[model samples]
Target: MKTNSLLLYSCLLTMAACAGKNNVPATETINALNLKKGKTIFCGPADKQLGAVSFKISGNGKVQEDFNMALAMLHSFEYDEAEKAFADVIRKEPGCAMAYWGVAMSNFHPLWSPPSKEEFDKGVKAVAIAKSIGKKSKKETAYIDAIGAFYDVNAKDHRARCINFEKAMEKLHLDYPDDQDAATFYALALNSAADPADKTHAKQRKAGELLAKLGFDKSFHPGVIHYIIHSYDYPELAERALPAARKYASVAPSSAHAQHMPSHIFVRLGLWDESIYSNTIAADAARCYAENAGIKGHWDEELHSLDYLVYSYLQKADNKRAKQLCDYLNTIREVHPVTPKVLYSFAAIPARYVLENRMWKEAAVLEAHAAGNDWKKFPWENAIIHFTRLLGAVNLNQLDAARTELKTLTALHDELIQKQEAYKANQVQIQVKASEAWILFKEGKHEEALKQMNLAATMEESTPKPPVTPGEVAPARELLGDMLLAMNRPAEALEAYASNLKDRPNRFNALYNAGLAAERSNNAGKAADYYRRLLASSNAPGADRPELTAARLFLEKQKTLAVR
Candidate 1:
């Protein structure tokens, strides 16, 4: 019943550790610790390496069935079984590594949708586990290290692998000098361990020093050059990084990791003007690569590049280009099947589209695409996507669906409680939550709507301080705008919406609500202006088609009011 039953088979390590053995049988035994609902079972975190499992599993046990089932599902990748299993795992072991990893590896992954604090905590716990599991012997340590590497592939626990790799590098280089691929592995480990800025600059410096010392670039690893770009005081190094980046990009243009480098470098160097060019090249390269790269790996980089293209165009203030990129992203869902990443991207379209003219119908269609499906495909994003979908339901006056969404909200909150993750809603999720509240407000359930709004605001206020991304502020302001608009306080909503737009004008949530806030305020001229702007925005490319039809209709009705 243990969430993280480490079940270290140390006694059997003698047989399995032999380098002569190619395959290690699943340790012959798994020890079970009886856990029950409401009993606080401490599965020791890696920090707590009581050499025990983890204490953060919380005292509750309802989620045991859920976590176990999810493990089985992941072993099979049976989407439905994986979804159910993951949901239960999170419900049972909210703070355990298994829950986060299970959900991440599930048919429906949390990070794929609207990520929750719960999943992040579980991820953190998983990382802690990797760090804490102190192995006594060489073989035991290697096996533990291997398992840790296995868990770190997911983004949430991704940083953990970096740590483990760095440790491995230290051991191989300093402890056992004869290890194979030590330098390459060491450099790779540093790339993950180095502070982004420090890593980049240091690599360039090291490359230069190595060239000077050895009379050539003896460190021939490609990634060393990739990390050196503009992160530190190495102009020569960064210049070198570009070609290295270009070379890798050329060879594996479809690799999301490869393509992400050069564009990110250019963007970080304050080269906005060149971003569109870079983004396009990388996106196209990635797409081409993905298409031709055989059948095994999924096309993560191509989709990521498409997203970057959308953002790049917006930064250049090129609405047309942004729209084109968004359209491409939209079509990906239709072309690809249902992975968590694909599905969440599918839902994000409506969230952004709402900012355009007003395609209540179009938005509904996108939301419906995810309806009754295994939203569990995206655990991290469940909160965001569900909240956004609920907004579409409210916009179309599907009160029943709106209520159903609230139940989902409750379940998600319960999950968060289990994980005890800090809460501060991302800008987009807040807007969606507020949008749903506005719908509730319109249904004459003013108090209920206020409670919903309050919950969102509370999350914003109470969320733990994490490093804010540059565009992170947009979601909260937009949500406040919707809440104010619903309260018949358009003037306040106008200010909130304006602030949100000014911070991230490309955000669809803010753009869509700008017109609504104006209309309710009876500022006919301002309303028309917002609608026109909405039509021109890039977040939702479909705006020209029918998104603004409703806003246009309203403007026509208000034409005579220009008498003011």
Candidate 2:
């Protein structure tokens, strides 16, 4: 993992050169030099086969080796490395059309953020170079055409060009049924196009079905397993990809994304232990990569992994791990300034620790602006910190502090909306209303508070969930249940908690509150059932939750009385 800023820039500019609309060198000389039709190539390293794909390229020796290596890296979403490798191929064989395609495709970064204008321009230049190389085989021509669709400068929108590229590949795959790379990439396009808001996830389902038909031996292809998990990222679909999720880490043991990717399914399925394991590996990989590469900032993979790691630890009531993670997050900035992704994790870790542990006092007095935490860079993430602060303030009957935090949340909501982050904006607004509801409840406006909280919960339910964060600060309806219980409305509270469980299953806090509500309502059977479920799922130590003790004693007393 060598850090070469100069090489990175050269890769980008050189890649762009291939996309440029300029004179191309004669292709006759290059084409006459090498002619390789098709061969079955093993992906990944020789000792550890990922799978076999029948690929054809017009190159031999080092050119062929580097090209295949570039493809494997691209399949794993190692864009920077792929770009550099492809650039090296260009140096070896300037006329290799598919090598130019590699460079162009690497610039596209299909699974991550859309490419910048310069990247698109460079990709277009690279495609132009491939075309200028002269007469190409039909197979080479199809590959060039697919990437050309991506770099088609006439197509202004990047996503539209991406769709066009996918459509082109669809035809190529249909034409050449044996090309697994084309089929796998086409599946990736479908998964990328799937709308998160559409709960049906029709596109994702189609992608998964396509991968399944390919007879994707999980051990054989990283993309097959990687895309399967991605296609089924949502909670409803997560269980369907459990086998793929479980196997992905082993398939691409060195990939940071591969290490972290399993947790998407794990978190969705509430498999806390598995999630912890996946994230721990991911974080270690990220840390080592950053150190070895001489990368300064907090690595994106580490931050993403830590967010999931913290959430899983909190769920399991591993207070020791949670505290250590929080401390690590606080000190991470000493190494380098936080990126936007790191900022989210830094804010979220503390918020999760205080709120999840029910340490209202710590949350109430938490420093709003920690050193190296740039609120201006990421107001949306800052909203999470404020949300927990507001929660604590409301719980502690600190109306002034609650009001101030609510005001700050409102400002963040406006900023997010202005930035066109509508989903995050809506999320912030929901938190704002939740805080307002809490404030109203403290002011003795019980009816108003319930009405407000109900409205907030409804809005949150209808809105599409945020993709970046591990989870919401807390579900509004669950908060509503807590408030209802505080007001002695146990029956209503129990209903609220139950409603929350329908959408967000296996959440420990909601189950605990629901049990308390049932107990207060004198429904011993329902109380016992809820408590038993909580205890079964809960990893909280004995001294951590007295409610557990109360539930146990009550059940034991009931058993004794029944015996009598």
Candidate 3:
């Protein structure tokens, strides 16, 4: 009789929690239901997928339905529906952790959303209660999984957001050990947290070394060195990246990700032998992987493996292998649909091949196919599609298409006005402007190009510099300097770089580019000083280090080729 009475009381509390229409907490900034579907479905476009609801959700009934609906709406980005759904969740379970996570997600996703302090606070509050309740007594079954997902975001703000994501992945990896997303997410998180400052910090160095045991190191990916080199404070410490780079190559000899990274790094470091050696290994390993995997893989796997194999061959100028690979690619793609990466890879080879050949029309078609045609099949490489359209259109002299791409990017930039990245938007603007400037240059309109470059400078200037890991400031500054140098205004370029380098003295690109600017101005003393500094620095990006050596050699021959 007592047990029955206790159960009845518990049921009453649950009933009370779900009783009302106005069940949501008032604190969230965005509507939970609206966010659930990401968009509102008007009466006309309503379909079966829109109406589907989860069978697993059996709760204080309506509230559970509301939560699922809200989660779907929010996931879909239909903020209005999500708002109502979350309100229902709150109504059903006033202290439901997922309701708060819903609010948090609606506010805090990386690309599209922005967080409100109120939503963050509410999420933190709910998560706190969730941790204690879910971990201890299994209070609510439906909310636990959602609670765990939101826990991936850190409370301390001490590590990169990726680090928190990695913690979440650890749980997921434990549950679904074979899922590649877990591995990719974990790799990305580690890649994200590693800053150039890590080069200086003993702890980061040890952590980097320890990561080798897990098959991740600087040579495995450029980001490994990039995070450390760019964020490194002691400009000198950036050299530490090399040891890990070598280690990464040797340890993971067969991994596609591992083979080429060391070579890429070596090329940047002007270590020609090492670069070639690593590139060869990467090329061979990829070839082997594709051949081995071909028999077992379905359409997608075969496509993926083939793409990697062809990419390595193309990079090495093995036209025979490239042709063979392309033939195989065409054969496989015709029979079976490949992933977005495969499409992008296929489009990219010809896009780059004719990049110098000026077959904009062919490239445009390939780019469009790669970017679009998703209705008949799954969408592949959505971002790459947009980027390829811009690149290929511009390459093929389809200014109209490139212009359209730029306009869309601008609109996107405007949409993200307050939420623009640390420096990426500025870089994008710089790229668009540089492209415009280059087209003008190609048309023998140096003055127009210079004007376009100046416009780029203005756009780049308007954006604020973000506090990031060491050496990250180079691209913007380099673009600025390159433009100024192109204008033959070495003094201004020098001043521009000086301003940035003063703040991020560890960034060696500034030093190297600064050397080039000095050389252009017939400032021999300054050029030598820059070259010497470049040679002395280890943190220089792999892409630019050869340019640095070239700059030094050019300086030596300056007297011979007097530009009258």
Candidate 4:
């Protein structure tokens, strides 16, 4: 396999050289010949296939291939492995300034969360070491300086530093227009600095356009394809990224993150089977990598992929698989180097299991801080636990318990606001208002309850989901439909569910309940149509979710009526 890969890489390089002589773009020529699926020529460890990446730098001549492999790992967001690869390069040649730069880059995850204090200090120290080595070419210096901006001590915060870093990368990209590394990293910086509230997706669109110029369809560079997926992760832009999403895993199948990243688009498009396939491989890959590396506990990537897997399963009405995942989650006693991603996944998986299944009593009893992680570090994640519990309490008419959960949610909301996490704070506020509305309905304040619920739904509809989560624990609009249904307003309930389904398609609860609402409104035809959709989307053999059963019975009854 290695020999074959090397031969393919040689052929590609030869083709590019020939194309350059003929004044033709190499990527376009390669695309024309349909040779775009070739693997990276440079070999790293047997298990780490991080697509083609080459960034020439002033490094030990023998370590250049290793350096490129490290850069590829970094592009795939396999930070731990990338850091080790870079460190190995430094051991081989301590004067390799670019190797030190890779170490610094590994510590700064652009899209996930800001570095911890320890990570920040490590990045700063690595940058200092690279600067002290100080014999880099102009291009290498530009790369170092761009990353250094993110570690600037005088910057107000991570966000401010992100903007500074983006500006620096923009300059570097402009200076080296022919450099694929510069363009790919610059596109990533643009996405990292994007404002989530900017519904126009201006930064995202710019990033996507920049990636497109790199011949995204034909380039085997993992970063090019990976960043393209992220650049188009938004609902409005998801379809544009479908091709990249479908192609990324094949390009770098050995990277766990590469396997998982495609599901971001899959989930957005409500492609449950595709998402399940992606994350299933990703989770297993993560586990295998950890075990092979002799790591004692789960990697955060494993948990992250599992969360996506569980979510997709629930959406497909594959409750048996979803339950098995929840069981698997419970067996995990530890995750190595617990980051925000790990915490969010640990908290979210169970919350999603209960809420998605509508196991109201189970949700009511769900414990917070159960993972033994520091919940205070992530108020948004903590709020998910409380919000799920609140929903359960409200549904079960446990008014006092619902109010208690609401109070805790309000406190978390205030905490997020104080931290200047406006997006998360707004999300928590929606939960608070929804919980309050449900509690009011239980108290017989029907008009007031409906009004408050509507406002919450609107607020939620305006807020796009963060990239970290599969979806909200319970979407506020769906909750509004539930409230309307409970109030015996089936027509209004159907409208609410229909609108929510447009944004979040193929949801089991929404589909089943939408059908129920249609039936209650005396629209048997519409109800049957919804039931058929539900059945078609969820064909898990022998899977018997009550909702699926209800849908089946409804359809059968309709068929009988037609025969009569």
Candidate 5:
């Protein structure tokens, strides 16, 4: 049956491409490929243009029904809920081998946090239990084997194990050509194994293409859409993901993360208004969920939403709303005990508020010792707090204080390295270098300062900024622009700001500073253009930005002078 279906689909594809249309409708194709469990079938649609994969399983009615529910949650990355649903299936049919597979799969979060030793052991034990059931289908055995590879304690490297699991899934997908879930998970595993530093993003793009075949048919599948968004998250590919990003929240409106996910593309595209709407809805929903669960402090979901919301507000010069969010975050510390996760957001809120608003004076005055409890436990989170303080000291010419903060950042970087957190260690190292460049400029070392700043910028360009924040504390090139302006080099400063804007677009400080730089360089027309864009982005009411007032006055004067 599977072989025949493939031949039929290949003919249809040839006909569609050569003749401009396949006489068979997509609905008919789906109907033809809907084979029962015992029959082999094609994994994905034979017609590449048609984006649906409908694979079904047959078993005891109640157990099969519950297993389907668990699978849906697993596809969407909802591990906790999936675990419960799969456990219910095991309870209903203790001998069901695939139910144990579901439990093991739920225990692994491919990209975010690696499973703990205990989690890996539990998943391995589950696979062992599934093997003991003896009545498992070939497809079930394939899944069990793939998870066994994932928990291979001897492999030691988590990423290498993930790649092994991906390879296993690829073979399973090919062997069971009719299993849509296998194909879907294979694409997900491809992304899980992708290295973000790879500029080609080869695996991510492949994952996106494979998932794209599911198109409108599986539009309601949260994992299909969610994975699509993640696959094309880079600035270069963000345009390609606009459709999926727009549709995901509506597809999974009940999901807090889903509501927030689209904003990733929105932020990349500089669609401030869309980002604002998405995060607002997400934050509200997350708050409701936290209250219902009797959780005092914000959970991970709520913190994620609030972080994005505050960022969007600052981007649009909605300082009032941003301040309100900061106030809300303050309440979080008062209500809940400090966990590492909550501490991350608690540190981020204040840092974002000051930095995004360009409140350099406030940052300068911020006390480093006021850092949240157990700050040392999470050096990566504490680094952001210290970064802002470093920037503030530089801006105020508090050289000694800035040097002290830079030492703190170095300490944090070394600590992260010792803990095997390579990515964050490098991020903090970049901060330290950028601060050093600032100090060089303060010392009137012009040539040395620019060289250090450029080197810092190059290092920054080598890696993408972590997505957890709306923007960097101070983009390296943007700091270079600040140094250029300090040296009375307006034209050169404008060019530097423009370069930074290419990667981090529509940023408030960059936009406003660009305008200032333009005006100082005697380019009235370009200066006016920059100010207009800045004003357009400033949609918040009662926003107290003096720069906003300056831009308004400058633009108005330009208009009056033009009338002369």
Candidate 6:
């Protein structure tokens, strides 16, 4: 049945091209591309398999295909490519109002950080141009107005503007229930407007329901599947998105974002192999796209993918690949547009490498603001470096150095609060508390250390991780477990490790430490179970990591005892 759908879709595209209509009916396109779990039909450029999308607009038929392509790119968060495609449509037909809308839409990434000042200006200009072209259909006007809400100069607050845009999209979707584009964009807006503090994930769940109702299993619309993944990108809901995560790359293989997006769910589920595969391809695609586009340095997508790649590889104890990636990252002199995404990845990749490997001295000396980029602009990113340095200093027994790092982190945390970045501020606070806890532990204040560590862990548990990172640099709960283990309270340490693992499964260090804690507590069965899990999670053949070796020895001993 899936094969038949692919064949029918190909035939439809061919028939449309041959007939010179340049327009495939939306219903027909959706029905023809209703692919199931199987082989994907590659229908376009090798680097541009944007699954079928038909957003019929009042424009020259000659530019219809280009418009659709741009729309698909927009859905996949390929902003640069989408902007170029929209520009091409405008060049061919100056009166294409919706094309201008597309350019404006490209500048406003709903799920990403708010546009930079330059990008915001560009979007405002595009919206103005679109409105100036007065002869527009009601549908076109609605689309333009919906995007215009985001570019509203009066609405300086990005969140408020996002809410307004969501309201606008809701009306548009209601007015045109049959329009797949309207429904998809509406769902995306809902996801974007979702309150991060709301543990219920009310808006995300609603968005997921809306997308699912659009026939996610059968619909080949990249945005539908992509948004479904975003809508369910939470720990509690991640499993529900596994099917979509498994299928998204196949649907839009050309999109770096599409390839990388699956890792959000994959990381949440601790599916390291799947996450690694997704990020490796995504990083390559991003590099290819950057080179082809004549971009001066790395694209943000490439850096983003590399960050995830480093994380997944480290999880599997593949330090060789992670080190190679770090070398590549070190060689990068610049990024195309240094957005928050790029900044986060820049800070995280190295931090993850040092912290994951537990290279204390190396981490202690790690530089902050090493790149020429202005670290002041992103206090949260700067905090990553300080946090890592603090952790390393504490481990190395450098009390003064740890306090200095902690002081810097505290200042950065204050800056985050001043910027009204509540979510980022909360994250930094967690780091601050953790750093203080470790410093206290080193100062021989075990009770105070545990108290601070538990506070940090509680705060971390209450906050859902943002989609930008795979996981925390060092989870506070895991740190608490480490503190307890160091205090020789193995039973309490084991309990803490178990709790942390429940939230963030399959972390190599966590697994090994949990096993060690259990063994020390004389729960041999639990120790063996955790040891076996650690071995299973790390698939690197013949890996001689001491942790891996220890797990192997412990498990083997348990097996021998069982046989006896």
TM-score of each: 0.47, 0.85, 0.41, 0.89, 0.86, 0.90
lDDT of 1 by residue, 315-356 (tens): 344556656666655454333334444544444433444433
Query: RMSD in Å for candidate 1, one decimal?
Result: 15.7
lDDT of 1 at 484: 77
Residue-wise lDDT of candidate 4 within 1-564, one digit each (tens)?
224433443554455445444323333432332211212322233766678987887744899988998899899997877887887776666667788689889989999888876677667656655554545799998898899888777678789989988999999999999999999999999998988778788998999999999998999999999999999987778999999999999898868888899999999888999999999888888888777766688877898898899999988878889999988888888788677778888788999999988899999988864564788888988888888898898889899899889989999999999999898899899988898899999999999999999999999877778778888878899999999999999999999999988888888889999999999999999999889988888777777888888888988998898999
Model 1 TM-score on a 0 to 1 scale: 0.47
List per-prediction Cα lDDT, in the order shown: 0.45, 0.74, 0.45, 0.83, 0.73, 0.84
| Cα displacement (Å) at residue 384, model 6 | 1.3
| lDDT value, candidate 5, whole model | 0.73
| Per-residue alpha-carbon lDDT of candidate 2 for residues 395-465, written as tens digits (9 for 90 to 100) | 88889999999999999999998987776788889998898899999999999999999999998877655
Query: lDDT at 481 for candidate 1?
Result: 73
User: Cα deviation of 305 in candidate 5 (Å)?
Assistant: 1.2
Indicate the residue-level lDDT of 527 in model 1. 72
Return the TM-score for candidate 4, rounded to 2 decimals: 0.89
lDDT of 3 by residue, 458-529 (tens): 665444222211112114445556667766789888876665555444235567678878877878878777
lDDT of 6 by residue, 1-564 (tens): 224433433454454334333222233322232211211222225666888899887865889988998898889987877877787776677567788788789889899888876677667656655665656689999999999887776674889889989999999999999999999999999988988888899999999999999998998899999999999998889998999999999898878788899999999889999999998888888787777766798777888888888999888998988899999888888888777878888888899999988999999988853553998898998899889998888999999999999999999999988888899999999999999899999999999999999999999998989878888989999999999999999999999999999888899889999999999999999999998898889876555678998888888888899999
**Which candidate would rank higher by lDDT, 1 or 6?**
6
Order by lDDT, highest first:
6, 4, 2, 5, 3, 1
Candidate 5 lowest-lDDT run of ten: 35-44
TM-score of 5: 0.86
Q: Candidate 4: misplaced stretches above 4 Å?
A: 1-47
For candidate 5, lDDT tens digit of each residue in 384-468? 7888888888888889999998898999999999999898888888888888888888999988989888888888877765666
TM-score, structure 2 vs. true = 0.85
